[model samples]
Target: MNVILITACPSGMATTFLGARRLEQAAKRLGWQVSVEMHGELEAVTPVSAEAIAAAELVVVAAERVPEPQRFDGKRLFRAPIHQALPDPDAFLERAAREAATFDAASANAGAPATATPAPQAAGGNGQRRIVAVTACPTGVAHTFMAAEALAQAGKAMGHAIHVETQGSVGAQNALTADDIAAADVVVLACDIEVDDTRFAGKPIYRTSTGAALKQPKQTLETALVDAQVESSGAPQGGSAGAGGGARKSVKERGLYKHLLTGVSFMLPMVVAGGLCIALSFVFGIKAFEQEGTLAAALMQIGGGTAFKLMVPVLAGYIAYSIADRPGIAPGMIGGMLASTLGAGFIGGILAGFLAGYSASAVTRYVKLPASVESLKPILIIPLLASLFTGLVMIYVVGTPVAAILAGLTQFLNNMGSTNAVLLGLLLGAMMCFDMGGPVNKAAYTFGVGLLSTETYMPMAAIMAAGMVPPIAMGIATLLARGKFSQPEREAGKASFVLGLCFITEGAIPFAAKDPLRVIPLAMIGGAVTGALSMWFGIKLMAPHGGLFVLLIPNAVNMALLYLVAIAAGSLVTGVGYALLKRGESELPAVADAGSGAVAREQRTG
Candidate 1:
């Protein structure tokens, strides 16, 4: 059979090429004529000609993401994930051959599209259940779509109605409607990144990692539906939910975490803009803003006067938005402003956000209005009532204590600066690398972000530096100890270098996930060194993020030269440590699939 095969991945990196190579070998062994086309991170390579497609009897698509499937409308088609195709290409090719032979080419050419593999359909059951789900991952790539596809197939097999919304690099696709959401018996959130789930309030939510969905999709869906049943009936069906489920409480806390992270994610851009601008102002001199009509003064005005001043309010408003959607924004902003005015700082902003959000939600839920004026509740009543309550509580109850707490925090930071810089740096740095972007890493990051408003920037500098260390160190280690890592890992290391410089500590997750014992300790050591040096040099960073780019601003860091030196020193330490500690490839596991499903290692090879 004449076949045209296409391989695509998020980064168009190693997976695409490896999948192509695997398929080619299989096709050759099977005595089939096949041409492969690669679609990758930046662009297409060795693209198949239109003539090739027209002449081919079959088309095979191997991708985590299928781009423009309709292009092969009339051809017999077979599809699988690009990663899985690498491990066993011969099986896919054999299946493709059988499918192509059975498919009707004449009917396909006449008008109807040829579908070799029928989609999964749910078996008839007691009752048809409708499900709505969202799948997301940190990199917005592979795992997002993989999980969605898995869940859809699982739902089909169980004979349930399912619609999956994919939030990926291409953005949200097949988005769920309000009516659809309302109708669903349960909402499945398969994600590693924090997703806004306020819309699913009053509906039972089931939380699972993207990996879980990929690995055990049917079980994941079954658990969700069963939990919903338990919640609705107030009794466990078959005792499964009763035995292993605190599902409701878990879901509730997951929703809360999502809200907070949403706020932090939204607040980051403002911090970057304001901090960078303020840093730029120092280029013309420390007090350049005092002198009018200069570029530096304008930058200072825009960055410090406007952006910085708005940061806390923006953070709080978004947090409330995550909780109560649009209705809570006004009260949240007002509360944040009050917190700033009262010198309660970022901690106050967080409290204001939660207060405003919960108050707005309560008002929306409890306040009854005439049907004729029900629309007015969102526009007029909720905002008015929530605002008043939040404002009064902030002024009367929360303002003074929070301000005093903030003052105490500031004093503690000052003390650390003089007496415990190294210890503080070591602790923060280790925390940053400990779980990558998990709770520990976030705690360190949040602490640093909070300190920005207080002008205690040394901690922020140390945190950023330490966070950058793991990925860069891993990249350097790969280079220094070539025999210690597999071919695929080395490819991933190249991508890690860029990610490290961008302050994405999650870049090291692949290496650490594969061999945490060897990788994590070395990473922590490197991170600690970077953090200690940053503290020792008294490096101050206005921005909570930006990595090396932040160093470009003259006044952003107190000691730019030393900061670079520290990063280099840390990277070297980690690289040498890995070289000394890790045995040759004979002792290490093969790195064929080292990364979590979400990370875009494909970008590295392509």
Candidate 2:
């Protein structure tokens, strides 16, 4: 019999191709001619031809999510879980053939794209176990797919049925079904960012990073099989994996920081995009918004009007998401809108997010409902109650106080002439580098960006200058003291300089994560110097962000030459400081540890 198999997963890595090879071998051994197609995130997929589809007697789909499946409308099809086709591929193929169902061409092709009718749950009745996993990374590229492959391979070797869902940059490939989660003995979450994990509510879950899974897949699987927890509906095992290993820190201790960072991470892109667009508008002169039908006006509308407006609501919504997953989005956004209306700025957005997040979480945790209407908790009750609670608090209690403080801060910054401005710049600069993109860094950024609405631009200028120092400084340091950095880090430094010029504070994250104690203090000192010089020179920037690149726009920065001088001075100081201070050989691993859990190792090195 002629057979065709498609192996597709997010990240389209080893998980897809490796499984395809195994499945092809299994089919060949079963005396059937088989062809396989591989779909991966990074690699180009070889499309299965229409001729191949038409000639096939049977098609087996072993994937977490198949992007398009309508082609097999008239064929006998089998939807097998990922793990089924790996180790004992012969058995899996035989079983799939026995269970394959013929599709009605007209009926299947009539409506929405034909979807795979999931096969009945594997009973694990043949002395095999069942497992399900979700693998993800911040970039959702290599590690995410590799981890899925590792787990699948290990599980197959152990004669266990495994299905891995990959969350990659392109999107989720093989999405887990409710039945898969239900029948699984355990759920493995090998990810570096927050996932929609609430789906695994009552399931036994084993949590770790993608790196951990790649390194020790067998251990991860073995541990999951034995020590997984039946998670609560309220919070996932570790409160949203904050930056680095900091997630392990108690919510009571770093919860505010973690949740705030989550909001900041989501909010920053809007700030950067809006800020640059607004800066671009300045090319048509400062009052470009007043002009109609001009590129300047368009930029203003996009930068100042749309993205800026959405920034606060998005911030609040994601913060709530971090706290209470998807259920918190609506309430948090509403709360943020109220905060903006009340003139509360970023602070208000933050408050609204936390309030909405906690309130939504509380509803999910405490507001028990009948099993018949339990679905209403996430859909109706949590959002409704959280929105109400957050809205009320933001409008009444939080808004007034926060607005007053923001107003005071804005007034104070406005009144500063030279010395006061310099001091403030120094503090803001120090804060920017102290934690690289952490709470303190974002706090200063938020304050500076918050003042854009009030037409106060110097603080933002100072903040940006300070923020740029860390990455540029580290990059310069790497060039000057190559021996202090590993080969890969030196390459990273070249990239850091470019990112630094673009005002991406995250470029310094790797250096800071490697040796916070040595790197951070030096960064802070340099940033402070840059910030103070920008303010003392009375230099003002009209744009909220965008480093050197924004200077290309006319009138974006008031003293472009002086601004460059300040950045150079700061970079030199930081580079010289590192050259003088950093002791011993570079401890940077040959392979950069990109995992969030790597922070614990950084702590040890420090």
Candidate 3:
């Protein structure tokens, strides 16, 4: 019988991939024809097809995130917990096979959709129904999109038409449309913050935390819609709507960097704006050497002060936006502007924005309401509350450390020299491999950019060279020594080239995270050696983002030939050592780690 399985997790990188591998082994052992797909970044393999789903006698979902609730409308489904799939793969396979022996395809087809209110829920094939949803988190970083993708991808794996919207640091992506909303049998809002528009007013609405969507989208979505039906059918109920009440769910304890991610997401635009404005002023405005005239000075000042001023508000506003949605827009902008005026710049602006938003949210949540309260959310409540918080933070919190850090970082860069440059290189390179794009990586990167002002460009070159080595070497070694890594990892070699040039050190993280003993130390030694060598050789580069590709760009690097040597040395060590220690399917189960889904996914498509 044809079978399709969906694999997903919070990160969709390692756990999902690992799960897919487990499922594959399970399917192979049973001699079952199975197809698998992921709910993550890489394009899906053997994506679920209508014919495939129709032909399947059973559908197995190995996931953390749930797809749309209706995908399994008329199918025999058994969801294997990702944990079970990852560790005791053989046991889960046996369990699923035993359960599949009991599928009642005929009865499922005869029933109405698993869930859906009669009034607004649209009917699907053989009385199946579909739910459409949007998932978001405060930082717009990990959970927000993972929730959405898991639902959509999982739903599809279950044979449902699922569309997703992601509220990420880049803003709303995969945006849901009016058509999408209208066609949905039901709408689910899985988020931490307030999403815009109450357009699904008459639709059977389901509101849940992102975790609910990830782990139990189908159950939750079904309850939400069916509960609405019970309510509409005159079932006596509490005054609240759906499973919740007028009060919003406060999502606490998400991750260490969630709030900070929101602040940074909000702050980036301000930097872009201010940086561009200042850069432009440096370009077209009066040069200090060209003119001493007052009008020339005025033009320069306006460019620097005017367009640049908008930066803070946008930064703060977006950070607030990331957290509270539309409500965050006003206070965030105002607080950001206040921060700039108070001499805080972007850092202060971010603090002011977050403070304004959280306080404004608290004020909005409590402080008893009158009939005018609805209007006050926009007209009065937000501004009054945001302004007070912004004012306080700017005067005290935002102004102090924000100002000092900015000053200190700038001073550090300005004074970097030939003697210190080599040390700086080692630091940046090591950081690049430590966590890839994490906070440590950011600090090192930010420092490199900081050095641009001081005209000390070598640290960036070392960073660039070091960053590219791990992924590239890891990729080459896998290709050169296929027997050392698992079948799943060998497949990942397909994407490693692109990651290598882009300098995404985390490309190697899946292997490293899972097999740190064999992988990390070797990779680190390689990285450290490369970083030190690049600096000692005085390889210099501009541009903080690009990797070896930058050398091809005109005049991007100094001592370009030596840069290649430095990169090659690191890459070789990382590649050879990683291959030697890489794990096979048997080895994977031995490593117990957090975020099981990520490990699974990385095994398949890392």
Q: By TM-score, who's the top model here?
A: 1
lDDT of 1 at 35: 67
User: For model 3, what is the C-alpha lDDT against the true structure?
Assistant: 0.61
Error of 3 at 539 (Å): 7.1
lDDT by residue (tens digit), candidate 2, 515-573: 55577779989999999998888778867666788888877788899999888888789
Across 165-191, the per-residue lDDT of candidate 3 in tens digits comes to: 877768889888888877877666776
All candidates' TM-scores?
0.64, 0.59, 0.55
For model 1, what is the C-alpha lDDT against the true structure? 0.73
In candidate 1, what are the lDDT values of residues 254-286, reduced to their tens digit? 456666666676676787788888888898888
- Clash pairs, candidate 2, are 11-41, 12-40, 12-41, 64-174, 64-175, 65-173, 65-174, 65-175
Between candidates 2 and 3, name the one with more favorable TM-score. 2
Output the lDDT of residue 257, model 1: 61
Off by over 4 Å in 3: 1-155, 158-161, 166-174, 177-246, 249-256, 266-313, 338-346, 366-377, 396-401, 416-431, 434-469, 485-488, 503-569, 583-606
The window of 10 residues in a row where model 1 has the poorest summed lDDT is 114-123
Candidates 1 and 3 compared: the better one by lDDT is 1
